[model samples]
Target: STRMRFGRGAASPAGVLRAIASGGGTDAFRLDGVDHRDDAGRLEVLATEDLAVEQIGYADVVVLSRADACSPEALRRAEERVAVQNGAAAIASAARGEMRGPSTLEALLGLRRADFVQTTPAKATHHHAYESVSLTLDGEVDGERFADFVETEVARFSGRLLRTKGILAVAGLEQRMIVQGVADLVEITFGEPWGDAKRTSRVAIVGFGLDVGSLERAFTTCAAS
Candidate 1:
């Protein structure tokens, strides 16, 4: 977790500071539509629009209140801008936790997690495919072979493929490993040991403009034995 400051207008920040100083758990740093006045009774305002991501990135805490983190469209724009400019900034969404859309799957696929998030149907510019399959075999796998399988299967349906993530078991390793692939980039890491819950490998593939049947077949045939 990163420490960062929040930027708000007028009494909103002061109110938030007051709440925090008083040991009250306030939801956000908003003035609730009230006119903001400073200690001298003059309007207190910050240059929010003029502040660049670089400035917001330096605060140990950031605040958002009310409609700040509301809709999916807003969330998307905020995420894109923050990602490109504020790699080290932390965010505080004051609009409550009502926004929902992105999931662990999307995060894994996108290669990063977003705080204020929402989801809508993907655009038509690209093909997308998604499928979940379970592997019954409990044998150890050759890492190279597994990697090759993932790459080739994804490529076979590349026209529509966007992302794929799964956990696999190798014949010798007691613990399973994780695999994440996005377009042409793929990564693998050691994960927790297979639990008793299912003891099977699960895979989900998402592709753009790709046929689901073809994507499924690609994985089914990937093992190099």
Candidate 2:
């Protein structure tokens, strides 16, 4: 990540190289070392910026640490990377205790229509369907089956997924429900219909990680009416 660049006012390459060679990790990148008056007066570790964030884009695992808020530029750059990586990275704050504490599935109980934020891959795309729909898996869909379907879909689209959300109408459940996922995490919830009228039981699956044609096909072909 280290790179050589002439400072704004200074033209001596020898001095910059000498400082870089002698400076420790902390001293190597310091605001004081770089002339504060001008923005481009110090050597920077480009890879440290790259290494600052890590992204995980798979089912069965969603690990987000607290190192995303390094700086506005850093976080902004990291987010851009996340969107491009297509759901490989989860939105996180590098500052400790800055979030609403650690995440727990407790909030997902009876949840429906979840919205996702950002990721490490910055440019991750998303999918949406406005019409009401339902899912009819043969018998019941185990966690493994659902994960497999999602993984296949992610790969098929090369990781363009940001968030997935929709209502799931189960054959046996008393009330309509919701299911959602961000990055690698997924959840299902139960809830009453939004309106007094009974909502059409439908499954709406959205994707940002890849072309949802396959997902749409899968749901349409397999879901129960």
Candidate 3:
């Protein structure tokens, strides 16, 4: 599992990293408030609570990006603020466009398995920023059908959909599948074996102005018939 990173500015701190971490099927476990970012590069007016607000005090790690855009003083000030806000969070800074290359991305998300583990629970705030729907299915699902379902939803949601991710229990594969998406982009790969974890498939869709009832119904049909 790659180390999940949350963007700054309007996007709340990565309270959702714990969920991604636990999805790795490791022996570790912890639940966190999810704050999936809205569409990348999209700007919007935020409420007072959504602006420069530190809702949680115990974030595991915080990645400071766009270092090239800020001077030494500005960067230092941002770091200082993070320290004051999430004192326990490990601070990592990245130069502009540093995350563009595939190799660079691998390094960022390839953090140690333990880094993703959270010791305390954080609640997700700022509901106005985005909406999310979680779906879990028992037994195996048809991989092809699941892919089709994702494609259909992404298209239907269009500019409103932000991301989709979770573990899947495929019809015949004992190894769990990791599903991830950003906008219309989606990918699936083999992960650790089911091991002692339940043989259940779970996924989540984060978007803006979603038709929850229709999405939930469409996703359920991905099950093997």
* Residue-level error in angstroms, candidate 1, position 136: 8.8
Estimate, for each residue in 60-164, the C-alpha lDDT of model 1 and write its tens digit: 223333434246565445543332222222233334433223233333223322221222222222111222222323334566666666666566665343344
What TM-score, computed on C-alpha atoms, does each candidate reach?
A: 0.38, 0.32, 0.49
Off by over 4 Å in 1: 1-145, 158-160, 195-197, 222-225
Ten-residue segment with the worst summed lDDT in candidate 2?
A: 34-43
Candidate 3, residues 1-225: lDDT per residue as tens digits?
799888754543333443454356665663332221111112112112443333322233345566666677766666554433332233456565453222353453432111121112112345344454666788778989987887776568876544555678898788988765544445566778887777777766655666767876887898987
Best candidate, TM-score: 3
lDDT of 3: 0.52
Q: Once all C-alphas are superposed, what RMSD does model 3 give against the true structure?
A: 14.7
Compared with the true structure, what per-residue lDDT tens digits does model 2 show for residues 115-192? 233222232222221111123343333344444555665336433332344454444455546555443344566666
Once fitted onto the true fold, the runs of candidate 2 whose alpha carbons sit more than 4 angstroms away are 1-148, 151-159, 193-209
Scored against the true structure, residue 118 in model 1 reaches a CA lDDT of 21
